[model samples]
Each structure stands twice: as structure tokens, then as C-alpha cells.
Target: LNGFRRTPRPLIRAEYQHWAVYVGEGHVIHLAPPCDLMVALSFYFFLYNVRATVKKGKLYVVVGNNDYRINNILDEKYEPRPIQEIVQDAHGLLGKELPYSVLTRHCEHFVTELRYGKPQSCQVQLR
Candidate 1:
């Protein structure tokens, strides 16, 4: 699979998996914590009145180009959509602001949605 390394916080390393869809040519699309002003500002205003810290995120289409090493792949029991459709779906989300929730919507959910046409997070389900 083409994705980011599953580098969680040291204390919770085994508790999560960051996922991304392999869109060919060493590129992948995944949701991640906000890394720039456009996303941070949007989430800040969106959560203005909320008591929780505004840690918003967005979807990124990155050209990893062998930055990550391949490990074993988990075979999810769903048939993936056509490669072209999945690639299109992933590309369609590039740079979009997304409401990210560890327990509801995360990286795994993003990739699964593109591949299987349904959002599902194994990490959340196992919790």
C-alpha cells in the first residue's frame, strides 16, 4: 500500500494506523492534521464557541516517492472499486478541509471510502 508510516505517539503506537490511498506513481491521498493557515483558520472559526481545542485537519495528496518502506498489507474483506475511480475519488479530495475525529473519521476512513466506497476505520471499530 502507498501510505504514510504509522507513526503514532510513542505511548499509543499500537493504537492507530494512518492510511492513504495509493493513486499510482508514488502518490497518495490521506487526511491529516492541519499543516497550514487555510485549514487552521477555517477550523478555528468553525470551532470558535466550542470548548475543545481547535485541532482541525485537511486532506493531502502527497508524492511520497519511496519515503516509506513496505510492510505487510492487511487484506480487508471488501472489493475495491476500479482503480481509475479510486484515483479520481482520492484526487477529488486534495486540499479539502475535513472534520477529523479519531473515533469517527480519520485516515483509515478516508482511504476506505475511496477504495470500498464506504468509510470504515478498523482502529475505531476495535476500540
Candidate 2:
């Protein structure tokens, strides 16, 4: 149920609303750009030396923190799928590599797919 709020960062605009699947226990699954290995190399050369590259992004299970919060704007008309189905759908994509596109494939699409069995992005559709 996580959604985006106002932020100054150029990457996060007002029109955008990020989404994630709440897998309970304060954990969430969503798609995001891979962590910068170059940055890790500079900070922890010895301990964190692993080579990994992603074309766009990957599904990640993360904790609910300051990064994700609820937004006022959401589709009230939408209904959620069964909890078991949603959980299974989210787990099925765990650690899978997914190409990300702001218009075609984004966080909204990911969460919607898990909850509705179809990939969709209201923001992109609105535009």
C-alpha cells in the first residue's frame, strides 16, 4: 500500500506514485534499480566485492521505512485479490530481473500485477 508523496528530488515528482506489496511483518516487495556496485566497491573494497549488473531493475524485498509511505491518491475503485494469491504472486517474482520503464513497466505495474493479476499503471494511463 506504499505510495509516493511530495519530494524535492528530481527523480521523484509530484505526479508519480510508487507502489509495493505489503507482505506483512513490515516487509515489502517492489522493483527498483539495482544498488550501485561501484559505490560499494569504493566504500568496502574487500568485503563487498561482487560483480552484478542489471539492464534496468530487479524485484527486491525490503523493509518498510522512511523510503515508503502511504499516499492520499489511490484508485478507490480497485479491489484487492485474495491475500493468498497476492502473497504467492509477489513471491513468484522474488529476485527476478525485470526491465523497468516509467510508462510501460514501473512500481505501480508491479504491485498491481500482484494484487490484480494484470500489470497496469494509472499514472501512465492518465497521461
Candidate 3:
């Protein structure tokens, strides 16, 4: 992470637009559903997961939206939380379960909450 900028960058694969927070050493923390699909309702709740650390190399194949325009715009509006606090909070949330809502608390929401102390998803906004 150059500039220690732990921003929430998108991971696009075909039609999927997933989001993750880069926290240096080529690792990212993200909230994801149990499967490849973005939303899954299992009886009662769609499971929103926190992947403790994922390598950037594994993401190279599906990387898209290189400009990270959403993040840039959001960064401009909200004063981001300090890198250390953001990272620490992310680590602390690993293995925890967050309520999953496609139009609300998804991956983008998760990382933004970690980075900016506010939960906002451009995906949700676009919807």
C-alpha cells in the first residue's frame, strides 16, 4: 500500500463488484458471502463473512475498475480514519459475522466502515 493508503478498492469479476480494504503486505480484509454469488439467503440470513487476509496476487486475474473512482470520491468527502486504527479494527472483526443485506451492509459497506468510520456502498447507491 503506497502512501499507507488503506483504501477500499473494488474486485470485479465479470458482473461481480466485490470490495476489499488493502492493509499492506499484499493482503486485504473483506466481507463476503459464503459462495461466489454476491447475495444468498439461507433460510433466515445471508451470511456476511470477513476474510482475514487475502493476497493481491489471487485477485490479479479479476481486478477491474483500476481508477477506484468510488473510493476517490468518498475519500474526498469523509475524513478517513487513521490507517492504524482502521487496520486494527479490521483485524479485530475477522471471523465475525455481519448481517448481510445486498442493498445495504455488503462488502463495500464493510470496508468503508473500517476505513472511514462510515458504512457506504457505491454499489448500493448505484442500485
Task: Rate residue 20 of model 1 by lDDT.
Answer: 58
lDDT of each: 0.52, 0.52, 0.57
TM-score for each predicted model, relative to the true structure: 0.60, 0.58, 0.66
- lDDT (Cα, tens digit) per residue for candidate 1, span 1-127: 4432332321122324556565556455667645333234433354332121222222232322223333223345776677788777677777776766555556666667777777876666776
lDDT (C-alpha) at residue 103 in model 2: 56
Best by lDDT: 3
Kindly report which residue stretches of model 2 are placed more than 4 angstroms away from their true locations once superposed. 1-9, 12-15, 35-78
Error of 2 at 94 (Å): 0.8
Model 2 residue 42 CA deviation (Å) reads 26
1-127 in candidate 3: lDDT tens per residue?
5122223332333233567666667566667565543363431254444222322322332244342323535777898888888878777877776676665666677777877888887766774
Evaluate model 2: give its lDDT: 0.52
Question: Where is model 3 more than 4 Å wrong at Cα?
Answer: 2-14, 38-70
Off by over 4 Å in 1: 1-15, 35-76
Q: After superposition, how far is residue 9 of candidate 3 from its true place, in Å?
A: 13
